[model samples]
Target chain A: MIDTVAGLAADPSGSTAQDVVLRAENVHVEYDGERPTRAVRGVSFELRRGEVLGIAGESGCGKSTLAYAVTRMMKPPAQLTGGSVVFRDREGRETDLLALEGEELRAFRWNRLSMVFQSAMNALNPVTTVGRQFDDIYGAHRPEMTKSERAERTKALLEMVGIDAGRADGYPHELSGGMRQRVVIAMALALEPDVVIMDEPTTALDVVVQREILDEIERLREELGFSVIFITHDLGLLLEISDRLAVMYAGEIVEYAPAERLTDARHPYTQGLLRSFPDLVGERRELRGIPGSPPDLRGEVVGCAFADRCEYAFEPCRAVTPHLLDIAREGAAGWRAACHLNDPEHRSSVSDAEGPQS
Target chain B: MTALEVRDLVVEYAQSRGKPFRAVEKLSFTLEAGRTLALVGESGSGKSSVLKALSRLVTPAGGQILLGGRDKVPAKEYRRAVQMVFQDPFASLNPSHSVDHHLRRPLLATGRARRGTEADTAVAELLRQVNLTPAADVARKRPHELSGGQRQRVAIARALAPAPDVLLADEPVSMLDVSIRLEILNLLDDLKRQRDLALLYVTHDLATARHFSSDIMVMYRGQVVERGPSDEVILNPKHPYTQLLAAAAPRTGATRAEVRAARQVRAAARSARDAERRETVVGDGCRFRPRCPFAMDVCATRPPEAALGGGHRVLCWLQSEGKAAA
Candidate 1:
């Protein structure tokens, strides 16, 4: 079904195609119902071989939906409407992910790109021991391995993620949430996949535990040299860990930039998000959150989806749909923003003191 | 005036085994009108237990909850005096009932509003207070019709329907989106000041906790290991556990190096705590001894409270020993 328009042309993601691990090109997803919700609208980005790309947005912005579409995990009612996901193997062979089917799709996942699902830390089976569950995953993916080889691999993976290898016999109930999450991550890494997608992996956990898990993932990514696509709504956190960030609003990528530049954001929605939260290490100041909620994406959206809530929305913002355009200063690498203010003709009158250089 | 005072609060869950699990102990604090106190801790650190004991969700094994200098107040009056704003506003509001019903019943039951006309007027006023415009339209809609932030606002308005003196919020904004969190938080802060309501905030986000509250109490496994002015606790932490938390906080200006350093601190702390918790026999002294890097011989017994001046205090052997050395 996705064969149409897929494998169109290669996405130009700053980096050359050789180093790009996973490239999502113009994807769209919808939750079909009485009023269909367009969850993802033409989202695209590239994952470098050993870099971390962060996708961030609040609930209903479709960050999670995009992940589901790209990973072939979309269920009924949630349809992957359009676009392409190209996963480049370590052998430099490109496979159109959306086109994979049956056993080919099954073999593609876990062996190439694995995902540690949202709240996956607590997703371990209670009745089965941690080791047994890991062995089962190995049994499915690596049928050629002997029983002892699978057991040895499980212990090694557990140890790599900082879990005690001996605790493999323990049930999910006996281990803490953090430990359970570690086991899930270990299982994801068991196949030594080239890319690991973690969606809100540290959410709802204790601060100490959240920090500990992030540290382990970073260490593993460094040692194994696999790329990561870390998804979360915590913008501040994404800014800290991710090398590049894609800010989404109303099911569209509003801003894509290097993490540091994102702080001095080019898009008003991204700026609104940065200004929304109270800073931990700074002088206290008054903060005004973006007024009004996100616009409903269930129906036909006219012009800019964020214009109603945007502080700088003008006449053109209501009439013209803004596409992602390069808003970076001359010579700067990768900064694209979907806002009329970035357009020379439609730029807002009150220019930022640190606005982009042509 | 002190709007609410809690003394030696203890919350214990009865177990089928030998002893009941004491979820909270030695927790005592006072909330004066027009002030915000943040209780900062991880899960199972007794943050919920504290809120639960205050709102009368679970009967505390021991404690005196004093509102206006009386602990013997009736259940009905206590309910009116103390109100709670729970997390997950989607779950907090009734989907079957209209917003009007959610607020009207509480307003009339507390005698804050009369029947029919007066009740309608009062509900409109509450909705207006939360910035839910054209109260007429919002009042008729069910919880499903409203957005998450709006639902939270409705929950806040409902909590305020009875005109409570003390407001206990347990992770109220955690469920909302990143862009709308400040709207709800700023609203809560504004209400706290406008109504002079004593606010007790419970959360794990160190940054927001320190930003919103005048005082911050850091909890570890049922006991408060550190307490001080919010800025002081966050900036110059004494306890090792507090330092770990400060390191874990996500900040705007943290460079990649700083993030890596924080990660290093967390990884080291996790391993150290894991090894110590398994080997150390932490009898009754400091609950954090297992995780405390600077654990000493006297940690087996309760450490003496050391005053760090300017309303700051810490329950750690390191602080006390350092004070003696100084």
Candidate 2:
């Protein structure tokens, strides 16, 4: 089906030419269990070629779930409850990723889309040499390539990322944290995928190493012209690397805007995130962390998920769950936030701290 | 009087097969009892090595660790007055042990608080000091039951159990996610102020270091590159390494795309450096000459002399030459 779509889309006379590489509509993901959790709710986004979109949230915000859902990596108990993640292939064919089965899904895993995870170091086989690992990844994806050809290609890729080709013989343990991360990145880039998803790839490394690895990712994206969906809890790091930012509360994106808007957000939750983030530059102010922890995800949340902790939450905020609404009062164009404070009709019900609590 | 003074500290590991690798070398600093001194450096730059030396976790080969103006203090004495809070609160706390066990053991081990109901009350008070409310609720819970922030509070409470006069926090907030890091840092600052305790904050983050400490020591390759008041050193870094670190910080106003581009260039250069494995001659006038942006021919001979002033010290030959010219 994808092949047919691609063939038709590639035809000059065909009317289906779209610039978007990936589009996920109304995505809902649920974990499988005797008592399962709904990890993602109504998540939607579009990835254009060469654009880096960052998913920012605390743990359990379903950011990672969204990544899995898009890549069709959802395992047992984790089911895509609803929505379509449409991927436009090189030939401009659109296919729903969730609908793919077995070989069709596996075919796109590294070639069209790839993901680098937090524990990517553990992803490498300790017994095998780095060269062998690269060979295996390339070999598994492209069995048509001979051994010597694969080796040459591997060396070229390693050199592209500034990694010494000599270290290809080193085992996983022999390399440092930064080097291992680079190797994982190199493997992700071997297929030259159009879309790359990274889930907290540098969370374990020191700040220096974190900076180094993010730099490498940014470089690869620039050189390869691939779109990136980078996930992490560090707002500072996200702000430093992402072109656009998505602020997720619970299982929903509360706000989506250019990086500047996030630095000065209109949404109350986003405001809290900006204030809570420790600035590497600027005078040291008393760091006021969010007063309360994230709401329990095991159960349902009513009204605003952040109301209990928000200093500015009001009555309407507690009684109703605000959907993404555009407000003209703020200078943010196309910048939307999910808060009743911005709705004129809802403002009457909201009054200070007494608005709502759970 | 200085709360603690370390002179010519050198930490070396002696493995069976390999030659001893000196992790920290000729590192020296002093902190006043009420002032906070931050040791800032990248990984493998010996900030943690300095902390381990103070805690007696790793013995120094050629330095004297002085506490309260006295050299060579006993480990137990140091333990009572110099408690350390490790980076990871979750990993630091034993999973099986309840919060009560975590706090009470340290109190009893140091003989600060006795067993039974009295120990429990003291534990409650310590928890209160770190702002853990309804302390009893957390007392019965294991580490996994609490949030990362709450577990860190417990760890801080446990460290305070020994009633330490000096606190050594090594990357205390680094392991924590950014949202909660400030709370922990503020707690450390407030505690240090109230207790008049000398603090040795060891970390690679200059932003947090500037926020938490009064004095700053920028280290590289086990040597002190620049040392001064935290504000002066961070805002007006004289050392090339310090300048590089300050430049590397992610600024809020800078767009991610721009920072990413800049970082890509830096990583490429660093990778090239790593491949070379350039050696720095120990007896050279300037150890950082190879990586230094402004290396002069004079840096090949004698090691740089220390330029000391009011709570500021630097060992760069540039500063020395500037002083002599003036």
**TM-score of chain B, candidates 1 onward in order:** 0.95, 0.90
Leading candidate by lDDT: 1
Q: lDDT of each model, Cα atoms only?
A: 0.85, 0.79
Which docking category, incorrect, acceptable, medium or high, applies to candidate 1? Answer: medium
DockQ of 1: 0.71
TM-score (chain A only) of candidate 2: 0.89
lDDT (Cα, 0-100) at A139 in candidate 2 = 72
How do the residues A37-103 of candidate 1 rate in per-residue lDDT, one tens digit apiece?
9989888778889999999888889998888898999999999888889999878999999999999
Residue A91's lDDT within candidate 1 is 83
The candidate that achieves the highest TM-score relative to the unseen native structure:
1
> The CA-based lDDT of model 1 is what?
0.85
